[model samples]
Target chain A: MRAVGEGAGGPKSLPLILARELAANLATPMFLIDAGGTLVYYNDAAEGLIGRSFGEQGEISAGQFGEMLQLTEPDGTPVRRRDTPAGVAFFQRCPSHRVLQATGYDGVRRTVEVTAYPLFGTTDEMHGVVTVFWETGG
Target chain B: MDVGVWGCRGSLAAPGPETIRYGGNTSCLDVVLSSGHHLILDAGTGMRPLGVMLDNAGVDEVHVLLTHLHLDHLQGLGFFRPLFRPGVAVHVWGPASPVQSLSDRIAIYLSPPLFPVRLADIPSDVTFHDEPLEAVAIGSATVRAAKVTHQGPTVGYRIEEGGASLVYLPDHEPSLGVTLANHPADWTSGYELACDADVLLHDAQYGDDEYPRHVGWGHSCVEHVVDFAAKANVGNVVLFHHDPYHDDDDLEHLLVQARARWTSAPERVRLACEGMTITLDANGVAFGAQAARA
Candidate 1:
């Protein structure tokens, strides 16, 4: 598990309020990433799915996390870090939904459906991205 | 028929001074028929206040029509006061799931460590129903559900009574099917729901510029809603499920843009705001001033 410092980009960002609300309440596994794709926050449910706790490992960059977990298509073809739902949602300023297989930090494999949407500030500026995912198969 | 907008914000509740005017609750509507039967729509955070009102009024029975099992749509169920009252009866109806029963799907959140109490522990005689394929009657009104394009299995609804009808389709993305080319037949189902409706409450979650980016997000822009309302010949089109970031002023501007783009009877278009009310009957549709809090 990893925890970003209190004054880190996520908690200090304008969209943190919404992200925190989602992190606290949503039952689905959710991850919040900064505009630059640094892993900012992952809720309890997300930690369960990722096989690690945010409190232990600290913040992980998108590239590092992708490389470590090795997310891939259902058939095991590698998926580019920039093409992940969170990546596309952040860069394209849109919402994206896809199903992919991921190897967790504990080496457990799961097929998950992920929906990622860009988070915007009050000024309509893109601030970050929120991804909600759930394991699909046993 | 009378309709009250208990909550209109989309995605999540945004309660604060900035959202006070339009409202910050998620998505709940209180619809009452001529016979005084209550029809609740969605179950967003707005349901909290609505539950208070219903409990105060001593209403004992509620028929909840959920469009889907999305969190924002069902979050208020746990807090709805009536559901905890021993004598109150609550019937929840929603789209059927192939993998799990509707009650089971809702119970996933209603029970265990997530909440302090379980659905079975609630004193209300709560019942969940998988809506039938055809229109069903509740009191004098007939309710019909049709599949709509969304991320999951979602449905739009139409309620008709006393020769007047109202349609509610709060989250929809028509372009998804049109773009896919594999589901063209589903495109016209939205128009069918709105056909000749006295009030058509449709999703207008984004503006023109914001829509292109959210193409597959299962929400519509104001322009698309207005165009559909015109083609369906709806008596009134209420732009609903406002984006959480849009303030009242932004909604007012969107209303202006919607009216300008409406091909016929621009005055018939309106924006859905929390606390707003509309009455529908054989004679015509009438809008009410914002209700004062009790």
Candidate 2:
């Protein structure tokens, strides 16, 4: 049977399409979210950190992404998603970075460094945001 | 608004005795708003005739919304009468390229050994819009262009005028990345444009039996197109971009298959044929005359 969710159908603008392509090429973990805050794509490297492939998650809302991966400070202090790099980049339309602790879909907790930036066109048109992160936990 | 198909033949211009019934031109559509605004959807060979009609009507300005720079889609630009007439304002809009600007990409074909005339050699005052993510107003009509899945940089347009919406996705392949069945409306490519549209001219270039061989070709088969229309819940589905290889009988067969699939289609499902016009008003969609033979 054909696998679902790798590159599921969605209204992807050119920038998002190119971002997804770029993400797939990078060995680092990456995730692509749409203007609507829907998690549209994630790279194969991201699958390890995510504990599941993008084909498995399909498309999830931003809130859903938060619920799927609850994050906290290194000391286990609860943190709001809006404080994360992805959240700041999405809401502020700028670049952001952070080191946080999180538990992925597989219930494994890990500390990771995350960097995110809004995807923009040459004309400064906002397509969405691309989030990349490094995993410290296996 | 009145939507007319000047050329529905897809891929290549198939002018022959077999294609006479459906007309043998590539993908050009003529849209006339009630306010006398003229919009040509593509610059296929059918555009030549549409340009002549505009010239006969003495229209000094026109907008051509292109889906992409594919040869069949751009085949009629050189012959379009308005582009050759001085004092004519020709506005062309299409998808943006990664390496070059839209005008430069178009110029690649308009100039050189491929064509005798250069894009600059045209007499009309031509303007090219590289990428159009923002909606633009042409008269009272609002035109929105969205990127769609195809072989290259391509987009589908949604034209909303006077409470009626007509979406033109002449060369789309929404089934490329994802399966069409039970997919969320928002997830399907070109869904937003076709959602509740009064008339949708969607790509239905292949039959189901032939789709497997042409998966990445960026054209939709009858079954897939019907599935997309159902998901979009459009009012009427006008099967567009007929394969140049398919003759009238083949198209008729495809239509029959489409009807079978869309049994509960709200208004109806019809094939886009050359010279076929569809009108939209407060009363709803009304079929206009066509050059089709009995």
Candidate 3:
């Protein structure tokens, strides 16, 4: 988890600040992945859903996130990076939603419905992507 | 105030010839105020010896402050001889979960199936109190608890008596707070608890090379501990909670490496060894004879 005023490697951008503020007050599971695809922050509610806090695990790279979450389609096929909600939202620069199966770090698997959207700066440049999700069931 | 290290090893008791120099018992400390008040920290296997000593000394009343209900920390309570003495009063204090009282939380391990006797079956008069988040007075000492970054709802303690203060955070992960986006204020609470303390006993359970694999394991590497100690400006920093795999020689090497990182008074950094006693008073912090052996 990067500090609120800092990004993965430098001072925080405007969109990063917005993402941090949005994640701070969120009660539902929410996480922010920077433009570099590094997980910058995950809220407390998100920690409960993931079975581990971002603080404890430290920053999760995009590849690590894919491997750890083990996101899969309803048909048991692996979700490609471009097809994943966060990937679509960041790369495609649009809001995306999907119902997928995710495995937490503790090995608990849950069917989750997730909504992802890109956070853009004042000049319309994408800074990061925010993902809000909840467990659909066991 | 005087602090005694009964056990400093983490995870499990590692009693053997190789571990004898540093001691193998898990996480127990004895803090005695100049006013004769005794406070015990974590009832790990080391507490058995402490209990025997206290019992033999005819000390009737004792207060135990537990950081959490981890098995290694609670395992020694069953063997603590003082609890078997009739009419002796033992007060236990610890963090309570939202759904369970501290007494009930401890009873889960102290009861049958897991253990031979129930907490209620102990001969001594025992009482459990949910420790407050704010500072509370226990005899002549005042202690405050702050939530730390750990796997569970673990808390670090700061004990102050007279003009001396000691901070104990034997299981902590400073890396957890680096991002500070989740709980920004919590990132500073650990530092605040140890700020200018006479002695800060912190977890140094891994070496720099061994930390990547054990990240988020609720323990700190020696480098992190040294960095935190220097940031807090503690008078003395004792590296406690030695990993089970680190033997006496390994710890000596780690201590040397840890001291080299301390730009401040390098002499202020030390390792916590079993039987070592540290006394803090107006005169300043003084190490007992055991420290000389180390």
DockQ of each: 0.01, 0.24, 0.03
2 or 3, which is superior by DockQ? Answer: 2
User: What is the per-residue lDDT of model 3 for residues A50-75, given as tens digits with 9 covering 90 to 100?
Assistant: 88987797776766887888899866
- Winner on lDDT (1 vs 2): 2
lDDT by residue for model 1 over B85-157, one digit each (tens)?
A: 9989899998776578899888998998888898778899999987643689987789987656666767788
- lDDT string for model 2 (A48-105, tens) is 9889988878888876887678888888887787888889987788899988888888
DockQ for model 1 equals 0.01
Task: Indicate which candidate wins on DockQ.
Answer: 2
TM-score, candidate number 2: 0.82
A63 Cα displacement, candidate 3 (Å): 39
Cα interface RMSD of each candidate: 18.6, 4.8, 13.9
lDDT of 2 at B143: 91
Q: Which 10 consecutive residues of model 3 chain B have the lowest summed lDDT?
A: B180-189
lDDT for model 1, please. Answer: 0.80
Better of 1 and 2 by TM-score: 2
Residue B194 in candidate 1, Cα distance off native in Å: 1.5
